[model samples]
Target: MIKIITKVTLAVLLLAVSVSKAQNFQGQAFYKSKTNMDGSLKIESSSMTEEMKQKFMESMKKEFEKEYILTFNKSESVYEEEQKLDAPEPSAGGMMIKMENSNDGKIYKNIKDKVSITEEEFFGKEFLITDSLSTYQWKIEGESKKIGEYTCYKATYTIPVSEKEKEEYANFKNKQTDSKTQFLMMDEPKEQLISVWYTPEIPISNGPGEYWGLPGLILEASFDKTVVLCSKLILNPKDKLIIKVPKTGKKVTKSEYESLVQKQMELMNSQRGDGKDGIRIEVHR
Candidate 1:
């Protein structure tokens, strides 16, 4: 009788261990992001009426607010924006103006390997940008807050603009002949301060869109003019989530992609007479 009891106990322990391991390997997090559009719309336009500009700004604001889903496991994650119905293009002065959606891409990050791959589309051309994962020196503030049912702690970091970004900004400015518009672009800072809230309960050092290296999953992050917040989380769903790296598109490093884009912009500018008269191009990183 004693030998039989020991065998049953061992079997139950093995089953429990297997279940725990499975639970720790998969999760899905839903996030909603919004950007502050007030600064961007503050520029004075000579040709556009105030009412028309206000209407255009409203339309642009809608594009800045978006929804995303992050599927993650122990060491890897795939983050992509959720699909939504397209709205009609907003018109000003009898011309239809379209806002460029900057956050259209699939970001795959592998924390264990310290690598990141992003599939991006520019001017109808697709690119796969592979590079090292960015590391952050987070200063934990020892403050805590609750995001839904999970408790989160505060952390902050600073990031300086790269030379590539500076070059892009300069190119964008040179294309603008309006002094007011150029001044607005020049007012943008060269560095940004980021604040994040993460929960250790989840035990994953990943977040949405180039944010990671925290002690847990980031529930909320704010930097520059954008804020991303976690709205929901699901753990170990019945249907397994497969995290795969993007394989299609022209593969290039981060710096290489920037150079390619800059060269294309220069070519386009040279072809057009007084390119400043055309639609404004906002450089998106």
Candidate 2:
């Protein structure tokens, strides 16, 4: 009897190890992202015609509505946008949407290392931004909801707007066109609070790009007129995924990269110089 009991205990231990090895290391989460265009669209426009607004929203749709895949493990994760062939961008009165990040942009984070690296393109130049992980002072609220099969809880953090962001947004208004009407679409963003729903079932403190340190896997996140929600969860696929850290690009710290980008924007803004002819839109993502 003693020999049989010992064998049973050892077998159970082996089975537990096998289960952990199979389901706990790495997985993929698919997310659907969309911008809250309603705020901009609802801004009362006395001078801009409805036709102008429609054309502008149509052009902005492609840039804002997107799909992304996040592949994560115990401590490291990679987040990247999924690319699709897009139709030719529409334009209205020389006004158009321009994205600063390249289609190949990717963000990788290592929670154990407390670091993040981003691969992005700016003005035909590729950049690898390396920085310490930005932490959020998350306040867990007593709110819970069902996301898929898991129960998700809400947590939030708020960061003040940067002076540079404020200055750029202040300049984002329509120029005096030859038409009789004029309007301003953007409002200075205030109290930039972010909310995320996380589930403890996954037990990975990871989420979409730049969002981490949650108690569980973040299922949905929203901030600054944009929302990203996990649409599918695939845990422990047949083939193991390798989380490869990005190695290509000009290496620079996050602050250094932002400075370079600001310099380029200054040059462009000087050239743009309050043009007196058509609509102007400056959107930062």
Candidate 3:
């Protein structure tokens, strides 16, 4: 009887392992912007930095230009609320974020460099978005880690000033790109350390954030010190969607394009409230 019980336990454990391995990591993206000096996370546009506002407008402009056909599947559970099976939140402690991934090709449209092709160009039209304006030497450094039961290799990419990058930096130093912020100078290299975690268990060359070119799926990613975690996996769910990059729009590099957007946003803000007689509210107590 004891032998039978032991055999049953072993069988159950093996089954669980098989099920876990079969599950693919399928869930909506949850983004948590780093906190601010006030110890709070600002969600709206009215409370963003000039650079942040510029990037936001740039995204909008790219969408308008590309006009890519976009679609999204309904939200799956984020798994935050364990008590409630129907509706699960990603994080139960403190604040759990709810976000949708910009799945369509439009998200890549703004990337504009050596990323992907659009729908407009001829058979062999070359559209160099960022014209070798800079080249930063990047290195991968870190320890190996495991995201799920899968073993993952962790690495850090450092943005250093290469020869081409320095030249662009000098050009930007002479003139400000726009009123929002000055461009990076050759000597002044802004360092950004991105931690990438990829597992060879899943054979796909993709990741959560900007890090890519791995043998398998990227389980987690971090940029500018903000972390994006993959909490769940859903293997081979029905109604699988295909990812194809679109190609039907005028191309523009990220930096130059963002400057144009910043100007427009600044103009709008000026009209709304530029230190002169802002929103008037008379509260009667």
Candidate 4:
């Protein structure tokens, strides 16, 4: 009886090990991101001709569409953009704007540890921003939809506009000489509604960019004028994932990083004669 019991216990242990190994899975998810540029063009100079405006809008549209890859496991993920070669220079009056997108850098998120490390570059300087993971109070609805081959459930969350955002909005509104531009700026919401479609079939509480805390992998997410959709997914590829936290750059918290960026922008603006038409910058992930 003792021998039999010992054998059974050893068999159970082996089964547990096998299960653990199976659960330690890794995959890669490809995402495509696009931003709406209509409202942005409306805020441009009213004196510009329609043809010039159309050209500018067309140039901006190409910048708005981007591709990213999220390599993740059950608890951790690293999201980054696939590097691209530089495009040809823009036409006169078509300023090349450096807009922020979802694929900023090596954003490492560990769900089990509830921590995140984001490596970002500002004006040629790298900063390692470390902070606690943002926990979203997601309201999961009964609605369901399909993104590609995966069935996804709908979820919603509201993000309050920060003081910086409010100030930027006010500045843009004030600078608009045209009534239509002012009206369009005013129509923009103070709070952005984030909509997500997650698939329980993936069984991983992970998503692209800064979004997570869902019951499953997020296949689609939209907030403000930006939308990110998963274009491809590969589960348990033969290549093992090496998840590592970024260690380079000046370490700072999220708020600290924002403050630093704001100060830098202010300095730049002051150096540029405080011109209202200098550049409107917004960072999103």
The most accurate candidate by TM-score is 1
Rank order (by lDDT, best first): 1, 2, 4, 3
Question: Which pairs in model 4 have colliding backbones?
Answer: none
Higher-scoring candidate on TM-score, 3 or 4: 4
Q: Model 3: residues >4 Å from true position, as ranges?
A: 1-114, 117-138, 160-189, 238-240, 246-256, 265-274, 277-285
How many backbone clashes does every candidate have? 0, 1, 13, 0
- For candidate 4, what is the TM-score? 0.77
lDDT of candidates 1 onward, in order: 0.80, 0.79, 0.42, 0.77
Clashing pairs in 2: 47-182
**Alpha-carbon shift of residue 58 in model 1 (angstroms):** 1.8
40-78, model 1: which lDDT tens digit per residue?
A: 555345567778767766766777888999999989999
lDDT of 3 by residue, 138-171 (tens): 3445568776687887766666556755665575
Residue-by-residue lDDT tens digits, candidate 2, 42-84: 3223345778767766776667888999999988999999877
lDDT of 3: 0.42
Stronger candidate by TM-score (1 vs 2) = 1
After TM-score superposition, what is the CA distance of residue 242 in candidate 2 from its true location, in Å? 1.7
Please provide TM-scores, in order, for all candidate models, with all chains considered together. Answer: 0.80, 0.79, 0.43, 0.77
63: Cα error in model 4, Å: 2.7
TM-score of 3: 0.43
Tell me the spans in candidate 2 whose CA falls farther than 4 Å from its real position: 1-24, 39-53, 86-90, 93-96, 101-104, 161-189, 274-278, 282-285
